[model samples]
Target: MELLKVSGVNKAFGGLKALNDVNLTVNEGTVHAIIGPNGAGKSTLLNCFVGRLIPDTGTVMFADKSLIGLKAHQINQAGVSRVFQTPEIFGELSLLQNVMIPTMAKRDGEFALHAFKRLDKDAEIIDTALHSLEDVGLADKKDVIANSLSRGDKRRLELAMCLVQSPRLLLLDEPTAGMSRADTNNTIDLLKRIGEDHNITKVVIEHDMHVVFSLATTVSVLAQGTVICEGKPQDIKGDPRVQEAYLGGAHL
Candidate 1:
């Protein structure tokens, strides 16, 4: 049950090749992690899946449908949701209001400021948004302004926003970045619980080995715009190529 597949994908920026013959498969309801050093094309590859960049050649399929040329919103409509490294939230809005926007977008197919005018009258959507906030432990602070939240809380809010969309696949780019160790561990627990509760497939691009080993059932290592090593966590840790990629052969 491959939920997402990338085969022979290639992307280049002028003289620099970002992704070269990259291929990846994410199974349904499992966490697949992509790891690499800086400039290794991890983010570039993610952008391709979400239509931010179209690969120069190859196929990207989601449940057998091609995702190469679809717009970002269209790809999102096809049940793919992305949470960026920086939390993408409506800073001026309340946390609940922030989550509500995506709920409306999921139902109405487009998001507009005018949609919030009708938000109060839509009890079902409000309830759904609240539930999403609760899942991420932000229900109590639902009224807090998004910009006022701490870094960790902002990330949780972003996850809630994505959850309201009921996406079948979630793409997370450095989900626990810029967090304290405590917050990072809490995020790992939250993600594991979300997997148990929602049964959503996740593809994560992360620099944190702890988060990766804790959540990823499968791992892919990219280097110099190519997938150099891929396997289970235990297998990947000992792979010489992965060790070299990260630490110049000193050991991961």
Candidate 2:
């Protein structure tokens, strides 16, 4: 079943067209990757899905409902969660605390630091957060300050935050933007494990082909804001259009 469907999507900035009648479909329980060169409107398309930017003309359907005008939080509440390029975590808070915020928000529709003092007394939410941290291999550091974590751990922390929400669709924007090869590979394995454990569908916007090929079940090539080609990883690797979209036929 298709979880996300974008049809005739168009967006523009003044006279510059960002996405031009683009269309895409992501099936359920698959890691779908959108790859493109810089300025190809990959981020723009993602914004449309999350309600940061509404498409000038098109329909974005998520699980049979229109996501075109929903607020960011509303979309999040609708089971769509996003991990940004930069790890978005509370630097001053502990790993457990960072995870608990979303857990509270998902249940109560809002969260506040004032309520954090009650975390120790709230076993249910704390257990949920601890399980999320454990899933991301951060349970041992639950008491550590968020800012003190390494980039890889910080990214894992961010994933724990998202996982706490029990999102049905996870959108990852450059999940491994800055990391060593070891960390990158670790993240790949972690994502794979998460998919196997949760069976959640994922949409990844990436520039690194290695990450794309390693994690993506399906690949879509975006060039100048248009989807030029899409297929399985091996098929995309051999597509000439994908090669041309990279750096002038320089082997995709």
Candidate 3:
């Protein structure tokens, strides 16, 4: 079953086209990756799906609903969530509190004012936030200030916050951007577990080949504002065109 369908999507700035006639499909409950060199339109394509940029043409459909015209928050409400390259968290807030804000917003639809209130009155919300933290193996650090955590833990905390929303489609941009080898492996393990345990569909935009090959069941390569190739990871790994256009070039 297809969970996301994007067809003939085009976006341009002045004279340069960032994305041109791009079409992509993500099946339900699978990890699909979009990869390419630095200048590729990978991030632009993601922005289109999440409503950060409105496409010049074509349509984006998620769970059978048209997503082209919706605002970013409306897109989230429509069951799509995104994690950026940079971790977005409240540095002064406790890790659990960070997760609680989104969880409550998803449930009660107000995050700003409610975040200041004591969470002790909402036992269910607190429990849900704890469970989300546990899913990313950060339950013990729940009370720690977000800024004090290591870089990897901050990434994990961000993931935990996103999970608390229970989004159907999770969009991740450079999820493992900076981390030690051990932390990278741990993140890979967590993503694998999440993919198995939940029915969530993931679309990741990353430059790390190791990360891409490890988690992506299917891969798509973009170059110069267009999709160059797409298939299983193994197929993409060996494709001569991919090697010449991306890997074999001086860049990698």
TM-score, candidate number 2: 0.95
- Give lDDT tens digits, candidate 1, residues 78-161: 999999999999999999999988998898785556734665888988999999999999999999999999988999999999
Error (Å) of candidate 1 at residue 121 is 1.8
Query: Which RMSD values do the candidates have, in order?
Result: 2.2, 2.3, 2.0
The C-alpha lDDT values of all candidates are: 0.93, 0.93, 0.89
Residue 194 in model 1: shift from native, Å? 0.4
C-alpha TM-score for every candidate? 0.95, 0.95, 0.94
The best-first sequence of candidates by TM-score reads 1, 2, 3
Identify the superior model by lDDT, candidate 1 or candidate 3: 1
Q: What is candidate 2's lDDT per residue for 1-252, written digit by digit as tens?
A: 999999999999999999999999999999999999998999999999999999999999999999988999999999999999999899999999999989988987844556446658989999999999999989999999999998888899999999889899999999989888888999999999999999999999998899999999999989998999999999999888877778793454
Q: Is candidate 2 or candidate 3 better by TM-score?
A: 2
